[model samples]
Target: MSHSIAPATISSPKDLIAYKVDNAEPVEFTSSKGYEERRIHSEIYKRHPHIHAVVHSHSEAVVPYAISVAPLRACYHMAGFLGADGAAVFDIAKHRDPAQGADMLVRNEQTGAALAKTFDNSNRVTLMRGHGFTVVADSIEVAVMWAIYTQKNAAIQTTAATLQSTYGGTGSDMPLSYLSSEESSVAREMTKRTVERPWQLWVREVESCGLYVNTA
Candidate 1:
């Protein structure tokens, strides 16, 4: 079948393939195929020309904020891309047809468009309620960084909030301090440029495992 590709089996550049954004038809003949998440990926690239890469991940630590009202703000400088207000929540239930029950998946064009719409001018991350989160960036490296640090921020935030509620004063009263808008802007610009450092480290680690090889 041409509708499935396993990441672990991929060894080099030839394992990768391209597809059209409009209909997701393969650009070249290959046994590999795109995943179901490609629906939102395609819609995002189609709607936002500036976004060169999109990463969707189900970081368990971040799922609490996605399903709750508590925002996932930047707990540290590295996650400044989350901004002061943090990631916007994209509820699949809002876009699902009444007849079709909520399965919490971007199953079609409507759900995909709804997900893409959540990425406003300031939104780099959108957390899908009861599902995973998506991060967008002008480059793949930056997107990977954002995805990694966003989950890290979530873990930190969750831990802090738990400790504060248990030991400190009221959790609501002692709200965790987050980066300001100005601070976030400055940190985002500064950290995005440093993505290559971590990218190289990650590439070396992956290559060491013998599961992947850099062809470039």
Candidate 2:
């Protein structure tokens, strides 16, 4: 589980708490704050064995599209992992159990399973309505790549749409031309080979800022 205060850091293996798919509490340690949300990751891993890394982010740029009627599309070649059809938004309300009550968070196994089912083998990203988005990949680097580009894509698309609406009078309601399926497919393959490039850059930044210390 991750600490609510510092969501991005993993100082050591001690930061991780082992837990089963069915249980809400960590078997080895006392529960952390916001521990219930960890169910989302466990359920996703239970459903997709091939996915080794899962990243959930509350990016402001992507949240608008998730809450809006429009879906977030892959506006550029780097974001090809989002696919041509765009990412699907998962609505917790429809799947929530009224008896258990609703908090819009994946707090239990049932809600987590519902969230997991929203993802298919080919789907790499799923946006949570009024919440955030999750990305799954075979490796941590690829997952980070998808997560970063998803935010970038949303910002770029929003800016482009605003420009069109302001200057061209097309309105933001109109859909901008997105990448074609063929374009995305080929680009997705090509981009996988370059994931390490950005990962190295980010690692360097972390080191330079002294955000991560190597105890080993």
Candidate 3:
């Protein structure tokens, strides 16, 4: 399916840059490979107009988990972002080329389409091994929230694993009952507000950093 970039309603590239800088991470939109990054971002943004931004990153823990033979299952309630059972893992192994590096596209439009197919009618997050994680939402805030929280969940699971050997806790197990009704209600409300705000703060952030430019 053809996907278009959604117009900025609240946030701007500046805002996203600032958020990344503050978090000590490089902004994907401003990197040398920004074009491909933007393409992926735009595709998701167009398909989900209600969302403000789509963020992807290579987190330390997630990177190892992605390359592992075993899938990273949601082991705690805080990882509800992965969805009730956990999200699907996309194998980008074939996309990796020693000459081209790990940036090879394992699957093109077809891959993206198939990867997204699993999330149909659901708010599931996906793990693109050797690539990163993709979180789709109705707004930038929600996207950012998921990006941050998902990393946290991974860290928690890792820590739990270390503790499990000695303490003997459940392994990579996330019970749906762990998701409280109140948290779910709040998530819905937050999503609504994020869609309304767009990337207002993100825009200001980019401007303040003196990185605002009309690349188009």
Candidate 4:
């Protein structure tokens, strides 16, 4: 989806930008990038019926791992949506074009379609090589946590890698031994059972902080 410009300063409902998506092609709103946003968002929605929301954010912590060989592992249960296996990085230049113009941005529908297809039902997160990351979820709340978890996970992974290096460790290292196939399956199943618990907890926290504006 097209992210809000200067979203952190958004204090009122009027500060947000909303768009009506359709099955047809997307038109550019302010500039050429607007068409790119329209097609990508609409195409993703069409492809994944379960996905009600998408988040595109840049994480400084995740930038290195995205551009480098380091992979995003499923190390944290809080970000269980990353799946038990691990994460994948979508590189437009590598995957789409090796010689010509394969910019990191999702500037076309084909690129957007390719990126959207990268995520199956098992995983909802992907690192855009050289750019940033995108998080897909059933709702905005879940998507928000997914984004946070992904950034935190990247930070933790980097720390773990550094510590291992400090300890004279090398090759296929992580904070802890990654989850086995069996363990990963069980972890995902447990997340399905406990999905709403964290949402409720977050609601209480937001209300307590007086940041819970009833937009609905």
> Evaluated with TM-score, which candidate comes out highest?
1
Minimal lDDT window, size 10, model 4? 26-35
Instruction: Please report, as a residue range, the 10-residue window in candidate 2 with the lowest summed lDDT.
Output: 1-10
Name the TM-score of candidate 1.
Answer: 0.90
**Candidate 2 Cα errors over 4 Å, as ranges:** 3-5, 21-34, 171-175, 213-216
Candidate 4 versus truth, CA RMSD in Å, comes to 4.3
> What lDDT score is found at residue 74 in candidate 1?
80
Residues 1-216, candidate 4: write the lDDT tens digits: 333444443456544335555543423343322334454566577788788878887789888877887667767666556655667788887455544365566755567788888776656888887888888877787777778778998888788778888885675543455566566567655665676787788778866765435443
Q: Model 1 residue 72 lDDT? A: 90
Per model, state how many residue pairs clash: 0, 0, 13, 0
- The candidate with the higher TM-score, 2 or 4, is 2
TM-score of each: 0.90, 0.89, 0.56, 0.74
lDDT of 1 by residue, 1-216 (tens): 115566566656676658788865677776555676677888888889889999988889889999897999988899989999888999888887777656787867788888989886859999989988999999989998899999999999999888888888774677788999999988999888799999999878887986665564
Check candidate 2 and list the clashing pairs.
Answer: none
Model 2 over residues 14-58: C-alpha lDDT tens digits? 566676655546676554554668888888889888888889888
Report residue 42 deviation for candidate 3 (angstroms): 3.8
lDDT of 3 by residue, 10-66 (tens): 243433332231222243434322223443444444455455556666677676667
lDDT of each: 0.84, 0.83, 0.54, 0.68
